[model samples]
Structures are given as structure tokens and as C-alpha cells.
Target: MDMRNEATHIARQDGARAASAQQGSAEFLTFRLGAEEYGIDILRVQEIRSYEEPTRIANAPSFIKGVVNLRGVIVPVVDLRVKLGCEKVEYNGFTVVIVLNVRGRVVGAVVDSVSDVLELSGEHIKPAPEMNTSVDTSFITGIGSVGERMLILMDIEALMSSADMGLMDSAQVLQ
Candidate 1:
């Protein structure tokens, strides 16, 4: 029957599409900072949890929002909005902590809210724009776009492990 033949053709087409998507695209977990959106590699994400007040540590950095005990493991929470220099930072019902594993250390990143996971092909991503010497843009891998939405693709591992971040002493300075 012609109808049966058409259904088989449709199934083949769908299978091909799924195969190409798997080979050519990477998945990013999207989240909000202030007004802008950001994307991080989904592999780095451990879990998303409701925001909670963390124990304040003495003499820690301003952006470091203290630490929270996650199943007996203390995770240092960082307000990404503050670290990224957002104009305003507010915590409400929608706020969440994105627990991430960075260089074998588990840390929590506070964000406004999570959007969804996106599979973006290479063509959908653009290289990060160049900035002046004073600004630090090294952790920005690229910019990703889907329809009208634009996402700042971040290399979270690099940002969290860098010496300046002070979250983890990953790169040792031979001084």
C-alpha cells in the first residue's frame, strides 16, 4: 500500500535526523543570570537544587555566597550574577543552585533560574567577541543562538578553576 510505504519513508527520515543531531551537536544547560542568559556544558552539571542559605565563611570573597552542606559534602556557593558583574542581584522563589563539578571539586552556582537543555549544532554558535585588555573574557567560549534567543556560552570549568576565581587552587603559581 502507498500509505504504508510513506510511513516507512517518514521513519527513515526521522532516524537520519536523530543520528545527525547526535553527531553534530552539543547539549548545553541554559540558565538566567540577570536579564541575559548563559549556557554551560551539561556534562559538568551534577544537579539543580532549590536555593538555601549557606553558612558564612570568614574573610571569603564577596561573590562567594558561603557554603552549603550537600549530603555531608560542603559545597561553596558562588553567586554567578555577582561574579559576572550584574547590576542587580535578588533571591526569590525562582532562584536555584546549579551544583557543578569543576576539576574534581563540587561547587554550587547560584542563578536566577534554569531554562532548558538545548542541542546546538556548530553553525548555531559564534565565537566570543574580543574585548580590551582590562576585561577578562577568557572563560567565554562562544555565543549560541536559537531563533530570537541568544545565550552566552561559558567555559564554567575554566572560570571556576582559574587562580583569580579562588574557588579552587587548580593552577599553581610557582612563586
Candidate 2:
């Protein structure tokens, strides 16, 4: 092929690649856990409610703060800080519960404070590095870098649906 034709073909391929990358972009609902910031897919979030003491369940894990009734449906609330092994777990006025709907089940996650929704392109999100980390990186889908801030993108559905959480069976979640 001629040089001009080759260059035009290459430009078209680059434009297509960029468009596909943008299509993989997603929005995340960011929140604070101790000093770190984390993000989850915005589509999974049902609503955000102020922190309220939930009914304690006997034999429940420490991280499982207990369950709350949301319009008759019982939703288990998991303290994200405790689950992530944070040393400090404080519930202040800014504390809120992020209600999530995963696999037809409703659950709530306790976060220090809700930040802003971030629109991140696929290029901005990098795979989580395989290293010895304080927080469990198993639940982390990727590391999103927006400007100077780094958001730990979480796989909330996987985390909540895991057998360890006791909310749902992992096998069912996989299906």
C-alpha cells in the first residue's frame, strides 16, 4: 500500500481504539474509610442513608454491624472499616450507610463519609498491583487515579456476595 493510505488506515484504527476505550468507562460512587478513599460501581448503589444503629444478631461477625429494616426488607450492614481491618472505626455525623442491591439482595455498607461520583475512563483505571497490602486487595477491582487522588475501586458485589460475609452463597453470586 502507498504511504498515504497506510497513514490514513492507522489513524482510523487509533480513533476506533479510543472510542472503544471510552465505552468501557464507568461511574463510581466514592466514599471514605479511615484516611483512604474507595469507590464502587454507581449502578449497584440503591440509596445512601444516615448511620443508624442496627439490630444486633447473635453469632454475627464483628464486621457485620447487624441488620436494619428498610421498608420491611432486612438489610445487613457491614462496617467497611472493620471488614477492611482498619485500626480506627469511628461513627461521626458524617458517617453514612451505602445501601446496595446485589444479586437481587439488598445490603448496606458503612462508610465514614460519602464523597463524589467520579466518571473514570477505562484508561484511568489500572489493575490492582499484586503486593502485600494492609487492606484486602481481593475485593479491589482496580486502582483509579483521578488527578492527585487515588480511588481504590472495589468489587462490591463480589465482596458482599462472598461466603465469608454470610449474606449470600458465593456459588449463587457466580451464577
Q: What's every prediction's RMSD, in angstroms?
A: 13.3, 9.9
Deviation in Å, model 2, residue 72 alpha carbon: 0.8
- List residue ranges in candidate 2 displaced over 4 A: 1-23, 132-136
Cα lDDT listed for each candidate: 0.83, 0.84
For residue 105, give model 2's deviation from the true position in Å. 0.3
lDDT for model 1 comes to 0.83
**TM-score to true structure, per model:** 0.83, 0.83
Best by lDDT: 2
Per residue, candidate 1 scores C-alpha lDDT tens digits across 15-119 of 345545555788999999988999999999999999999998999888898999999999999989888889776799999999999877899999999999999
- Candidate 1 accuracy as TM-score: 0.83
Q: Model 2: per-residue lDDT, tens digit, 5-65?
A: 4444454445345634676778999999988999999999999999999999999999999
